[model samples]
Target: MLEQLLIFTRGGLILWTCKELGNALKGSPIDTLIRSCLLEERSGAASYNYDAPGASYTLKWTFHNELGLVFVAVYQRILHLLYVDDLLALVRREFSEIYDPKRTVYNDFDETFRQLRMEAEARAEELKKSKQMVKPVNNSKKQGQAQKAGFDKGNKKREGSSAAGATKKGWFSSMFQSIAGKANLEKGDLEPALKALKDRLMTKNVAEEIAEKLCESVAASLEGKKLASFTRVSSTVQAAMEEALVRILTPRRSIDILRDVHAAKEQRKPYVVVFVGVNGVGKSTNLAKVAYWLLQHNVSVMMAACDTFRSGAVEQLRTHARRLHIPIFEKGYEKDPAIVAKEAIQEATRNGSDVVLVDTAGRMQDNEPLMRALSKLIYLNNPDLVLFVGEALVGNDAVDQLSKFNQKLADLSTSSTPRLIDGILLTKFDTIDDKVGAALSMVYISGAPVMFVGCGQSYTDLKKLNVKSIVKTLLK
Candidate 1:
């Protein structure tokens, strides 16, 4: 059943509600939606899931940008609600026609909503039936496509070689040959260049989806622009693509760890940072690297062996602690990680440590039990930063991992304002060479900056992300 529906202004003023004030939402689901999704520029996601003590919620929101209104629907997450989106659209249309900023209550619109919900549900049922009827045909088509795919797989290398050789004249040069110094650029004119760029990005290990979107963005920015005298289309396209790549790799927010550490020192509290990622991505190794970096600045650091699930996790951090001449807090394996982290922070505070680096067990994003435990630790401790330690060699899995990690953090959080990944630590950077598209893909997907890259096995091997160098390598 749908729990609630709310209509409000972007300014945080409640205009209407489907449920009575007596039965208003207990947990701030709307607040969570705005904080974890909208404010993070994740409005493009289809739905957001929130959890409360008794029930979980799936939220769908639609914005009436022209009128500065937000329409949100909240329902039990256990049920698959297909008509929620249609209902939202219908309500937006019908309500906006009657919406007025001066009026706060919408008593007369209840009748319209009753009729709209019925229409939306009816449409969903009819669409579901039609899809079921066509399921067999779709299955047959999929089988045919699968066979064609296998055949194509055998000839892929040949086709790729032919395409690569076909670009001997260069994609942009081919266009220049056709256009012969055209004054204005057009979308169709950039097709060859875009295709070449996509292939180039894919070769560098960029996800196909990210490559496609980057090409589209570059095409849009270059389309309808006037060209200069003797300017080759190749040069123009290269410059635009370079600029786009650099923009994507650039950090949008402040990633100054040292500054934040000093700020925490002033407040007499430890600057807590939690390192997390999948199995064998080097969370413990990178956590030590980060501890070394902080120690270099004369910051007293403590390691929290919150990775209690792994076999050698605590001993690993203790070894790092011994080498780094820092203290470590560990209760051994099978202990609650949240409790361990909490106790570690308390010890750090008592020992006058400037920073607390929490190393958690490596886990696949799809592991629900581990994910929930990770979320609990984060929610309980509220670290100053959550650095996702991902490998630089990851390709398309980079996007999937980061997105699901953030999703799980949001969905499993105990509070309205959930703590999400604030930064990234890219391990095995020296091994990747020119294939630096993983950084771009991770940053683009999570909107979190790559704060440090691990270049060696040594503790002092951490270094800052070189955005310009990466852009040059990608273009090269």
Candidate 2:
């Protein structure tokens, strides 16, 4: 079956073993059949096409002494490439359910799996022990062992807790004491104390190098400087150090970000939320999603279908409002969106609504006249949050839009008409793999805190943005 297959590319000679396969298949039963297959270039690579009249076939393969293996099956001349490369990651991912253990070459595969299972088990056990060695608590264990204890929820309150004035003071007091002692120690003769501690630690069987390193670390701490762990100080700490350095160098202004969001919220006497984005970027959909989320959160919401310039946009918002059983304020295509937004805010104020999200016109942030229109809306009925929504699929384009909008916000200011970007909302998050990275990079580099992320078009897809959460998800 393997001998019947051919490997051909545009400019390279077939491997020695592939040539041997051709020779071995020359007189075989399928030799004449294999010769009929044709080659074509696709995606800068060559593919083999085998066209037969009425053949239904299945293919399976194994490699005992090579870097790669492939198994192709042709059914009525429709071919399926089953596996590739030494890793066989595709086979391990797909078609894993159908790989039979009873086949000829697959018997060896079973042996290989067994070996892998044993190695995995051994590694897991080693990991368990290493985890046990750590000082940190693992919450998953049902019971605790001595010296490796977890949080004891059962014993949270002791039978006789403590005397009235007893127990160590607050964290600040203890920390102050520690700091004072360290300060005094820094002023004292260090060589003798270091030698004494080193001798004691070594006597307790600590390695000489480890003791010396620990002493140096302790000295740094005594001098009121943060001590670096030996692991962090190691020469092989490139990846971790680089990440730490980046974080240190690229500090975020969480306080300022929060303050701006709060200021925007406070500045609006009539609390309004305006969704801004370009056309075909899910701006209206995201506004509806936000409304749905607010409704789910038990906040009284009214959506303003103010995208009068776009056909069917009002209907789209109205449809979502009906499905969600939330009220909507909308006008037909000819009305101005700014007027709609103003009316919506007035209606929300009269109804004592918690939130009123206004879906504005579909225009690029770079459009100056459109931005002027947005500025007019803000001036007339100041919004609590001016969320700049953008597509995650646009990557760097999203960054450009954010920058332009932020700049406009900065430029469009009178004493009464102050505008600053409160937050950013990123949409189509689930469809893009690197969206989190791109979005975080946008926020980090542009100094904008992402407020919400739209993982899906559904109402429940709106998630409050946590920078740490985004980072963790992206790394994963």
**Predicted structure with the largest TM-score when compared to the true one:** 1
- Per residue, candidate 1 scores C-alpha lDDT tens digits across 52-108 of 877788999887755778898998899998899999999988999999889999988
The local lDDT score (0 to 100) that residue 132 gets in candidate 2 is 84
What are the candidates' C-alpha RMSDs? 11.3, 25.5
Clashing pairs for model 1 are none
Q: Model 1, stretches more than 4 Å misplaced? A: 1-181
For this target, which candidate reaches the highest lDDT against the unseen true structure? 1
lDDT of 2 by residue, 365-429 (tens): 77877777777777777776777888877776776777777777557654343676667788887
Name the lDDT of candidate 1. Answer: 0.85
lDDT of each: 0.85, 0.54
Q: Provide the TM-score for each candidate, comma-separated.
A: 0.65, 0.46
